[model samples]
Target: MTGSTEASLRVEVLGSQHDRNSFECGVEPLDRYLRMQAGQDARKNIAAPFVLVMPDGAIAGYYTLSSTAVSVGEWPVETVRKLPRYPLIPATLLGRLAVDRRQQGRGYGRYLLADALLRSLRSEIAAFAVIVNAKDGNARRFYQRESFLPFPDQPMKLFRPMADIAELFR
Candidate 1:
């Protein structure tokens, strides 16, 4: 499936035990970034994982969203001072995102991310930004192409303010 052909694609969240496993096996990136960190991050309330399933019940892709704390010092001074000192501002971290090899090139990854972002916007999560640590140069490029900005000090990391993402849906 590719391009316009995917207009009718059916994508939904993984909601069952089998679906979770399938989603795990379908994407290594998800496994590395989220599943492996499930114990330490997820259980500790640091992050949450979500999966995208196709109509046939096959796992197409997966992503993780989590609450993160960024120091006011990490942000530009202009943006930092505007925020309260030591504020635990809401943040959504895209811990991992991957499309199955079999489903690659179908734009499923974009769909998966869009779903995650939309959910964040709608939820009362209070996230000020969505952050992603790209696994490699390719992943970094992908996020950058999607309008995420790379941190000056950390090129592999990309971020998009929630307000900026919300504007896209308008």
Candidate 2:
């Protein structure tokens, strides 16, 4: 879909009104999370799940954001060198992101990820970066394409500093 067309789709907090049952991203865990645990996670203030709703009210995609912390050691050495001596750094976790299988290659994944990053950047919480734990190699590549750097020790785990992300929106 074109950027203008995608812009017309609403991105909002997941709620009872959003249909979660039919959302399938070709990933069982992702689909199951939306159908099953997303609501509970939202209610408990664990993670804030957001959904992309089509004009006809179908869910095109979803992502979750929550406060998280990472040990400084988990970062690349260059990243750690620039940080304070704090053992654990505050961050936002882009915990889960999925686009429905039908919407996969239409740029919905990038759209959802951009929305998630913007939300994280605008939050009042003191997060130094946005973190993601990619489920597989494809997922890892997806994040890397968006400039998320992989931790030296954990290739599938990645993050992009809030400052760098801010530059994109600016």
Candidate 3:
């Protein structure tokens, strides 16, 4: 989609009226989870879900964020040396992110991730990083392009410090 066309997709907090039932993101687990459990997760305060709606109001994609923490032990020694000596460091989890298969290559995923990062930055909670547990190499690579770094000991667990995110947006 062209930038103008892509811009027509609007993102807002998931609501009962959004059509999530038929959304498919190619990944069965992700698509199924969003269709089946996203709302309940939101209602239970477990995570906050946001949906991307096409101009016509059809749901195109979604992502979730929640308060999370990481063990300092998961980081490189040099990285940990720069932090406080706490066992767990505050972080925000990009718990789930998906772009509908129908719209997969239209750049919706990147826009969704950028939205998630900006939302995390605006949050009142003090989070040192935005963390994402990438399910596979492709997902990890996508995040890396957005400047997220992989934990040396855990490549699939990626992070982009809030400072970096702030720089990106500014």
Number of the top-ranking candidate, with lDDT as the measure: 2
Q: What's the CA RMSD for each of the models?
A: 3.4, 0.9, 1.1
Report the lDDT of model 2 for residue 7. 67
> How many collisions between residues are there in candidate 3?
0
lDDT of 1 at 47: 60
Q: State every prediction's TM-score relative to the real structure.
A: 0.79, 0.97, 0.96
The TM-score obtained by model 3 is 0.96
Comparison by TM-score, 1 against 2, better one: 2
Worst 10 residues of 3 by lDDT: 1-10
Query: Candidate 2, which ten residues in sequence have the lowest lDDT sum?
Result: 1-10
Model 2's number of clashes is 0
Ranking by TM-score: 2, 3, 1
Q: Number of backbone collisions per candidate, in order? A: 0, 0, 0
Best-fitting candidate, scored by TM-score: 2
Q: In candidate 3, what are the lDDT values of residues 87-139, reduced to their tens digit?
A: 99999999999998888888889989999999999999999999999999999
Which is better, 2 or 3, measured by TM-score?
2
Alpha-carbon runs more than 4 Å astray in model 1: 1-13, 20-29, 32-46, 81-84
Score candidate 2 by TM-score against the native. 0.97
